[model samples]
Target chain A: MDVLTDEALDLAPCGYFEFTDDGNLVRCNTTLLEQLGFASEELTGRNVETLFTLANRIFYQTHFFPLLKLHGRAEEIFVTLRAKDGSDLPVLINAVRRPAESGFVNVCVAIPVRQRRKYEDEILQAKKVAQKALEENNELITAKEQLEAHRYILDHKLALFKQRNQDLIQLNRVITHDLQEPLRKIMLFVDKLRLDEGIRLSASGEQVIERITKASRLLKDLISGLREFVTFDVTENPPSSVDLNQVVAKARDLVIRETGFGAVDLKMSELPVIEGFGEQLQLLFYHLLSNSVKFRRTDLPTVRVEIRSSIVQDNQFRILKDRYHYVDFVRLVYTDEGQGFDTRYTPGLFQIRKKLDARTEGLGFGLAYCKKIVENHNGSISTESEPGKGTRFIILLPFRQSDQAFI
Target chain B: MNVEMDIIRRSNVKVWGSGSRTLLFAHGFGCDQNMWRFVTPAFENHFRIVTFDYVGCGKSDLTAYHPDRYANLNGYVQDVLEICRTLDLKNVIFVGHSVSSMIGLLASIKEPDRFERLILIGPSPCYINEPPDYVGGFERKDIEELLETMERNYIGWANFLAPVVMNRPDSPHLAEELTESFCSTDPYIAGRFARATFLSDNRRDLPFSRKPTLVMQCSEDLIAPLTVGDYLHRNLPNSRLVVLRATGHCPHLSAPDETIQVMTEYLGTPSLN
Candidate 1:
């Protein structure tokens, strides 16, 4: 056999060692001894398996040894050696079984692979991070699909709600239009009977006819009021800038003419010009003022109107936070010395024809019409009342609202 | 939408020949149904021949190739059984190449009545050597190196490897055609199939097949060496091992005449050509 020189063997790039069949280390090179931080004497008699970590020791016995025995060599196998300082030395090992009389001696070479192992670990960690990101991306896709499905359902329901609302309005128009004909005929016949047959009728019979005629005229007024209320197509009307002070002045003129001027004291505050339908705004003021004067307390029959403006943060209850761009609102408050009802009636106040006081001779559509007008202007109306106390109506109108109305 | 039709479309099954008895030929790892082109022509006059591509290879439906479903060999065996059930074929002579050999054995073991015989060409029960008793002829490192080789020369590997693996380097045109076919396969599917083929160990499953199996081995095959053929013959109960004088892994491509001769003799059919 050709012999390798001592310098050639010692200066090699890798560590070399020879072990018996039982894994006892017989001899090791200077590079291996240096890598292990050990003296040659300390490692010579030790079991080579003891130099490895517990797991690597088992791997060496089970996989590495069997491979070497079967193929006469094992290449590029991974193992970790226990160093003198209790740290681990990761390496790639190649071993060859040598021929012997009784058994075989194994010659093994190990190359330090700490840098390679670190790169491999980084690759594995990068793989794990990539997998996590993929899973999260899948979850996000699923969530987006669910949101799309919910939006579809909401859009369908909104369409149905709009259809139902249109149908109800159409039905009201038909009923009101049809009721006017019979009312006109009844009034005409009663007038004819009083004019053409007055002498033949008894006085009690004539009095009964007069009462019937009066009730029919009242019914005709109520039907016309409801028809006018439903006919306001606020959604279709384009808005123009109107001064609330002018609107209030117009409403006050109507109230004075109806109540014989100077019947109730009406106070007005400085009001700003806002974008709204002029006719609706005028009718809104007319309804509130009429209610105040009609239900005024006998002792103190005055109504005060105050107007103010401020910014308001959006909330879920009254308005949708995302639907509007304008945050500023104008508040018009009306406080009157009227016979107020219980606060429990506040919810029913805005409902159509819901009267609070039975003694007050009203069709009870005034406040409800006021609420509809306020809503058309992209505003809200609310009331605060206490039994035996006065009533205060607060109307909140957006300062510079654009026409992105939601139904 | 019919399930049987779906299986037929997924496998790209092609049926030909006149005889009532069916010869279902399943292709192996690297190539597709085109690998049986030279050998099937001889059987066309005698038997009803069936040929198909594995999912993800050749013209089979690429969308139907799910990694989790094709992760193990049993999944492929299920495909073979589905083909049998869908076609309603009886007394089938299942001829499998390379990895498909073991795949066919597994199918016959699960449903013995569906198959009449199993013909395994260049088959290995285990690719890794397990010391004193067995020699599969390739070390684990060699297999790893083979995978790396595939990675490095994947573009030209089909052309380059076919000639070498078939031991016909002189016939470069044959390999060029193979290269075109290999390029047709989806790269991701090919990689997955490669990993499954090399890393699997089916040594313990050899004894489970009750069907009479024929092990055809080549003399100088690198992938499945001679000792593996002997191992298969010994483990299988009613089996025979034939050592062909051909020099490479693919006898059907390299020496088609000899392959046809042996198959016809085994089936007790006189030579027609």
Candidate 2:
């Protein structure tokens, strides 16, 4: 039952090829030649990559060769060969490397797997779609996890803020009631000593009494200022559309009546109506006007204060763009011709205890009150000043505040 | 695991031989460090030989494969440099094959004083042709089809090898044993590696590397043609191009004698330093 070896190889059912170690084709079976529709001369002397499709050429170099070199054999390798007419012939190839007289030779046998390739292509297409869906699902899960983490952080911060707010209210009550009672008694006793023992007291004793009265009065004013500062945050006043012209007029009259300085030259431009607490805005303006009058130099005969306002886009402010979502903001510039402090003190100027000058009458709560008021309205305030020069305050307030703006 | 041990396990690093000078061999995209078996023996007596499988290939710890980190050749470069740093290898001779040639070049550029010289085999700076200036012997469509072929073959091997792998759960080395007959990899990871290898463009990085380089190009390489070799020679500032008589992409595997002969001749020349 032994057949001729050459006849058996040439007449095999599957395609066969043998190439040198360099991949130059030496011989191929008749079945392979007929499968590719090529003459022996077309493929015999050419590189084996020429018989493969462009993709299969890359596969041959990157995978097929390396496998053969490493393991001496490669099995069940899927590739596509190109026929002479430029059609792909999908094949399953098994190859082995052997030592030859010259160097090495690679022998491969390929079976046309057109039917199995068609089924595999369908499965691959389905798998790609499934993989894409899985990737999208994974991305969604990641995004949801990030959102949950952010929510947890925000909730924790809100709880801390509420606790602090409760503590502030408790402190405000103690300052208003317990501290003020003893201070009132001190003022009454000091008055009684000045009236009842006036003739018996020596001149130096009268001078000491005058100091006591002045110190007691200053203490009273400080307690009042501290009360205003702490109590303003406790009140939950809804925001309303308040006209700035009326607010500034009322604040100016209060400052003039309190300080008894009638030589103020106030100039104001048309102001915009904004959403804010009316009383707080009035207090904000009062602090600004009083600060100018109290800090006025004796050399200057008249205090000149100018108020200018304009609408600006959010982009005009580099720092506040990310803080607020408003489309437009009302920018107010308040300049006063008074004795300005050194510009170096501008950073801590708005702090409650940062008194720049010792000669000022009241506690240094004027600028602090102004900052708190502006911030409560979801606005920002900055000041520029130089010694002996005038001071300018720039306040930016949104035209309409969102509900979340109220802390 | 500690940092040094983690890297060693993750990359499946192997070190052998005994000498003062070191030789680090980085394999290309398709296979692992085992591909260098035929060539490493020749240099064992004179050089401290080093080899490693990139993450996601061979017996490397597959759990360390992160798609975001391994999305490009830079990730593979990090694998090589980490191995060198862990071993405290200095003044190394880097021998890279295929895509790894560019990866080694980039690593040398990043750490300029680490490598003494670079020996690149069957290297291509870019695989796609930019017509009117360069011919890299591949088209964009050709790469796409290559990916398709890889997917098909990967699915075929996964189906065939699943039963063998599952049945030998007690044998930790059984998977490696089964995959020894071919360059087996995770299908998903292999797709990404193929994309990174074929779509990379390192043509601009050639002039920056000042290390002495030896470019060993095969005569009839389908991946890296003669034109690509000439281009590399012209672009690399301090390099010598030697066209090997051997053919195919892996000349060391196809003709180890010729590959080692040229390397020995080049290393013997004292002027390269």
Candidate 3:
């Protein structure tokens, strides 16, 4: 029989050991003893757990021993051993369990793996770093996708708004040109008929002609108001600095001349010049003053009007912070002592043809035109009123309009 | 498939044996239900034996694995209770190994009427030492190092063993043999399981369960030391502690005769079941 000699076993290149089923070391080669810096007597009867570091001891029980018991062998199991001097020595182990006369004999061979372990650890660390970067990249991609979805929705909504605006412009052209031409011929022929046939006409015929002239004039006023509201496109006019004092003064003269309400007292304060459409700002104040004179109380001989202006921080209005990037806004307050309507109708007051009182004169497009003009200048207008009290209009306009504000 | 069949297929549940009373064997973290082969045969004659693999282990459906759900021990506890409910199992005798011991205890606490008794082998409520009061036989750093070691070994196996298995296509049996030797597990799922098992602390849950429990501990278990066993015995109500003469963590695999004898003796004694 050819058998390995004792001398050859002792001088083997790798370490070897044999233990019983209960893990008490029965024998170990000299090479293993030299590797662990232990004498034969020190390791002979000790349990095999003493040979491993604390972490590898867990690995041995949980993985190595279970695998050996189930499959009768374990290969290429990585473990770290604790030498006598308390330094760690990494090794790759292969073990097998075989039955002997007394019990099972477990044999193991370990190869010292210093350089291989170092390289493997470095590779593992690099892999971990790469995995982390990949996760972050995935999160960034998700955020970008969400932003793109929002932009797509906004673009779709803007296109719908543009289409609706085009439809309204077509309807306004038909009302101002086609409808007004026939109505103008009726007024001219009615005037001619009244002048040429005055002697032959009865009292009832003259009364009917008078009513026809009044109704046609009211219809004409409504069509022109509708046209002015619809055609005030802010994009056609570039913004420039305009003084609020000058706009208010010009608006007051036009309102008094148009209404013939000479008993009017107007008060004002120093106002700031802000960047906005100049013609739209003047038209906005004209509609506001005209609304107050039209709703004046007949019992009071004179109408009182006051205008105040100041600069306020943008955050003062909670609704403006999300939409505007401006720091400061110019606040203009217009108050008048006139008979006011029910405040419940304030929400729909800015809508065209929304009238508070059917008995009152003129169309209900005054407040609506005021709202459109204010908004075209990248500003806002809201009103507060109570029956039998007075009316107040508050306006907020940005000192410098943002380029993206129109859309 | 129906929901009942789905549950059975999801966990790869296997039912056998001739007796009426059921014995459900739950495997530990690293391996699957096949670990109970040596131990299950002994009880097959007198008791009905039930075994299953947790999702992502053995032949269980891998698609059922959700990372957020299985991030902690509660997910595994849910799996156990769901299996019990789906099978309509009542008064079950649950036998668990390693981390599964705590899992069984938690399930019994959640539904006390479904469980009759528990036999915990090599159970450690906590793996890392709390210091000053408790010694669980390991520190946090040691557990981390164990994870690193596991990664090294898994990567090493993929690089070293894949080529050898592929080159031997002439013998298909050789490939099957190699696969059987190394329990097939996805490396990523195995890493997650290791984290959930070793980082868990179930010491607070010990006092809540009052079932008849048998704590079978090995004499020199490196995973769950003698102190941990004594700790369990003191805290677990209506419990008994028996230290086996066997060594290492898994006595059921190494010394099945002794394991079966102790379990049979404990069952034979008249108490609750």
- Per TM-score, the best of the predicted structures is 2
Each prediction's whole-model lDDT (CA): 0.71, 0.83, 0.81
lDDT of model 3 at position A344: 90
Model 1 is docked with a DockQ of 0.01
Clashes in predicted model 2 = 0
Off by over 4 Å in 1: A1-407, B155-180, B269-273
All candidates: DockQ? 0.01, 0.21, 0.17
> Which pairs clash inside model 2?
none
Cα lDDT tens digits, model 3, A20-108, are 76878877787888898988778756998889998888777777776666566678888898999999889998887777768677889
Candidate that would win on lDDT? 2
Per-residue lDDT for B82-165 in model 3, tens only?
Answer: 899998999999999999999899888766668999999999999899989998998989998888778788866653223223
Preferred candidate (lDDT higher): 1 or 3: 3
TM-score for the A-chain in each candidate structure: 0.57, 0.58, 0.57
Q: What does candidate 1 score on TM? A: 0.40
Looking at candidate 3, what is the lDDT of residue B143?
90
Higher-TM-score candidate of 1 and 2: 2
Superposition error at A36 for model 1 (Å): 37
